[model samples]
Target chain A: MTPDKLKTILLVEDDDKLGRQVRSHLTEAGFEVDWLRHGHDALAADPSQYGLIVLDLMLPGTGGMDVLKHYRGQRCDVPVLVLSAKTDAAIKVRALDLGADDYMTKPFWPGELVARVNARLRRPLANAGDSIEIGRLRLDQSARRLFVGEESVDLTRVEFDLLLALARRPGVAVERGWLAEHVLDPERDGTGRTLDVHVSRLRRKLGDRAVCLQTVWGVGYRLEPDA
Target chain B: MRLRPRLALTALLAGIPLIAGSVWARSAIERSNAVDGLTRLVLQRMLDGGRDECSRWPESWPIPSGPGMGPGMGPGMGPGMGGEGMPTWEERQTRMQAMLRGGGGPRAFSHLGPPVEFFAYSADLTSRNRLAPALHEDLRTGLLDGRKVVSRGRSNDSDSPLEIAVRMDWFDEPESPSAIVLARQVGASEFGLAREFLWGVTALVSVMLLTLLLSAGPVVGRARRLTRNVRRSATDQYATSIPVEGSDEISELALAFNAAGAQCRAHTDLLEQRERSLREFVEGTTHDVMLPLTVLQGHLTSLAKTSSGEQAATLRDAIEEAHYMTSLIQNLATTAKLEAEDAPPRRDPVDLVALCERVVARHMPVGREKGVRVEPVLPGDPVVVRGDETLLEQAVSNLVHNAVRYVDRDGRVLVVLSAESGRFSLRVLDDGPGISPDQIGHLTERRWRADDVRARHPSGSGLGLAIAKEVALRHTMELTLGTAPELGGLEADLQGALG
Candidate 1:
């Protein structure tokens, strides 16, 4: 791990053993780790001191969901990664709406936890711009404007974000789910249909240069330099 | 052909062949006896008359000189009965008339009502008479044996026209026994009457059979109904037993069937009850077993953090094993639930690409711990299929888990999810020693593992592929196995309907 001087994680877990293990792993990964054994203490903590919060959903004192609500209500901008043992889609959506930045199920690898925490901490600057350009298509970040060879193309919010996510890594494939997570409104169900329609609209907006955004087989979209 | 109607028909039609055959036999015997009786009576009358007329016996009777008639005509025979192999009965009647013309002999055949012709054989049968050589021999033998009774000739009524033969001794001239053969010439009207009588007998027999069948309708119907009841008890699953009406065969059959049905019902009830309890036990046990596995996994995670390098890898392996135990319980519960009549899986649109990714994610850590590479190659677009989401996940997870577990170090396990040929397919291919051809067929059997596989992964439940197969079947999909051409290892493929 390349040392980031400002990195610190507040981990909220109920299990005594799991809490210590996660704290130890995060501490070893060059992040100053603060372990909270109760959801109440996590809900009371100040988010200003931490870059990320790795919270287990099965907390003893305040319940992980309530803790998420508490911090989110207080306008806590710190990323919260909710961990559980199973994929309960309804609960996941609820947690995400309650201000969880990401979801990770239990029994996850230590490397994966660190990666998720790092990814969450590295948000916003991860894109570093409101716009991007690939091939014949260029997106103006500041004005949320798209131009294909100096001509502007109108796009919906989801369409713009979807194209931006793919354009950020021109040749790398973006996951179908990650695209939806970044683009679609967090309050909605965000079924695959909504994502598909957005992609279709975005492609149409790209016009003849739509071929630049090519779908990688067995993966997702990759914005190639040339069609 | 229902059992009842068939049985009734069998009983009614059973006697037709016997009745038809016996009628012909009885008629033949009656005809033969009638011929024998008539011939003997006529011959006896002639012999008695001959004895009485010996005092006035004509030494030389006028022979029929012309072709048909040369002498006096008798009162009975109107004309000569002419055909091959015989002096006509008419000619013989002419001779008898000539003898009786102004002659003083008692008329032997005048008292007889039927018209019959007779010929005498002096010694050898083949010598003088126009009689058939066979008939002549029969008559000669009969005479030497002093047969008082007549014998039937070999010729049937249709062939010789009612022929018979007899031998009698003449008391006045008993030196040489004469063989006499009589051919009775029945009138056309008389023949018609006899035929009418035979036809009447056939009609009467048919009528009798019909009447008997009509009277037995109730009995036959009862037997047939009993047969149907027995069949229904065994096949249609009729609930009630047949009613026993009387101490008869049908009632006895009903009793047997009723007893059999009771035994069958008891057995079925027992089996169903046992299955229900066993399903409950599995569900309860799986739920009870998951808690400890969860805590154990938590402890292992803590241990893995403290440990370094090789020890950490070993801890991760133990954690993976514990995780596998949890999955086994879940699969056992799921299969048990499927076996039960209740708790059917929900049919929903499941995204196969997303599903495969989740399964790959779960097994990636274990693969890393074991030094095998678990790679997921899910399609860019979602591969949607209509099935239970959890079940589809379980199926794919089982495949990916097995791939990671069975593959050698540095081997790659690739999970590919795609929509191909309008079906959603989730394929898990590994790069390891492939399963043998003989072992492929038994891969889906519950807890079945090859000898080498059991030796290699001794702790494996061997139910991973079996659970995958069961889940596939429940989703109305097929789980197929093969050796991947590229990977040179086991490839587990599940193809499901796309929605």
Candidate 2:
């Protein structure tokens, strides 16, 4: 399916102007956008109806962390994208720990916002079967091989781990820390910047398929399936 | 010796001589008078005895006559009396000498003695010729008158002594004449007594004068010394204390002076302490208040950007109101701080050009929106100076903001920075309605707004220039508010620090 064919998104923002702008842009990207003014409103909305949620940390009535706590308390499995003007690292880690799928700071480009939303909607593919397919690209967990339309592609250890993490999720976004913890070994010389170098290296190897990796400024990277 | 002793000695020296002279003169006069009286009485008695002896003779006696007596046949003749039954003239002379020598003749002759020599002279020319011519003439003259003659006479011979002669005529026989002369060696014993008396009086007077001087010397000297010390202490500026060694009025004066000095010092110290505390309080309050204000300004700027239409307009109005209120509070705080004594000035090296540029940047957006141009004339080199950076920045910002707010569309606001003589100066000039002469005086004062100028642009808090002036003063710098000569608008020149 095309990336624009994704449906259902949740936007949580306290600021009236920014929230409205974000909703309009996400709706224009062919996604059903449900907008809420604060953390309390987002928590009250039916979590199952939305595939993804854009949550702001600073919200009147109830703070974003409390909303995240409530969503996790209800065992809601919907993907959550945390949004805020707070750029501190501690705040991002806390949100991600509370089951938020990703985080973004304010003044972010609208295109990046749409991309992040699409990536969150695609997160279910990682748990579906262990084999995932996107256009000519295919990954087989059992074989440990990645093929582009019957032609096998070669990748380094770091590049293979990076591609698997993204290929498993299909269209979901993965934060920088998540990639560093799961794909990159702590004993090795790899870091967050190392992950980016590997991503760029992998994209170079994938060639025309590099459009799948997107940078969501102030947020982390996301993988988007081609339209 | 000291002045007191010297004065006493001088008094004694002058008085002792005068008293001694008076005593000596008095004693000498008394001794001479007593001696003179005794000599006169003794001589009279002697003469009277001689006359009595001559008168006792009977008329029948034959008396030797030379010049006064003629031939006479009488029982009392001169040769008859010369026999052993009566004392002869020589024998009488000897007895009289004995009487005078014994000092037993009379009470009137007390201390007087007999003459040292005696002589008799006859009235006959032949007897008188044998004597000295002066004696002979004196004897002849006395016999011719038949009168007793007493005269002090000196002999022609040097060997002979001074003599007193008593010549008397015999009354029994007129022709018979005789003179008795009694003389004594002139002894200095009587005059010596008078001289001794005078010397004794002089000695006594000198002793008394010395005693008087010695007794009065210390008292006078002490008094004079006290006067001098008091005068010297009064005129002395540094050593205003008189030594209080004794329980006297001078000691009391010293104590009073010391007490006065201590009181003055205490008062001065108290005033200084109070002034210092007041300054500290003002400085601390100003620092605390500025932090909150800056935060508030940042929040407002963010708020203004998010709202739209009337909401945006309302937010802008709120922000402006807040800015005005904050400015007023800042100005009031600064003014109060300045009025405090010994306020600690916030001094640091600051770049004037950079400071002015920052202020211009803060106001430039607004200026551009209003179609007013903000021209910053920054120096090529960093114009560094020592002053309070925050206050300087605020002052420059105030001037720039005011320019942008008041000037007409297309009007220019010029911020010029320059340095000379180790002093950095910043001037903000605008082509707007210049401040009137009357308003300039009140512009720097707290809450004093020019109504005429403010009416044209009521957005300002009217405390910008006041705060600027106060900040300038605190840094020991100058802030002059006037009309720019070239721009024909308000000009604020704040000069501080050295280049």
Residue B249 alpha-carbon offset, candidate 2, angstroms: 4.2
Q: Which stretches of candidate 2 lie over 4 Å from their true place?
A: A1-227, B1-254, B257-281, B308-314, B332-348, B361-375, B388-391, B394-398, B401-405, B408-412, B420-425, B438-480, B495-497
Chain A superposition TM-score per model: 0.58, 0.61
Task: Tell me model 1's lDDT, rounded to 2 decimals.
Answer: 0.63
* Best by the DockQ measure: 1
lDDT of 2 at A79: 81
State TM-scores per candidate.
0.58, 0.33
lDDT of 1 by residue, B255-338 (tens): 887888888888888888898887677656665454455556556766775799888878877877776776666566556655
**Index of the highest-TM-score prediction:** 1
Indicate the worst ten consecutive residues by lDDT in candidate 1 chain B: B54-63
**B1-499 in candidate 2: lDDT tens per residue?**
8654675577667757765666556545544443344346435543645333333432211121222222221222335233445555555444444433443334445454333333333334222212222454554565456555433332222233334445433334445433343333333334455557667766776676677767777556556665676567546532455455576665565567566655655676788678667656754555445444434544555565577888776765665555455445444444544455245555455677556654655455445445677766544356777665556666777777777777888898887765656776677888899878878767755432323232434454356776677667777788888998768899888887683
Top lDDT prediction, candidate number: 1
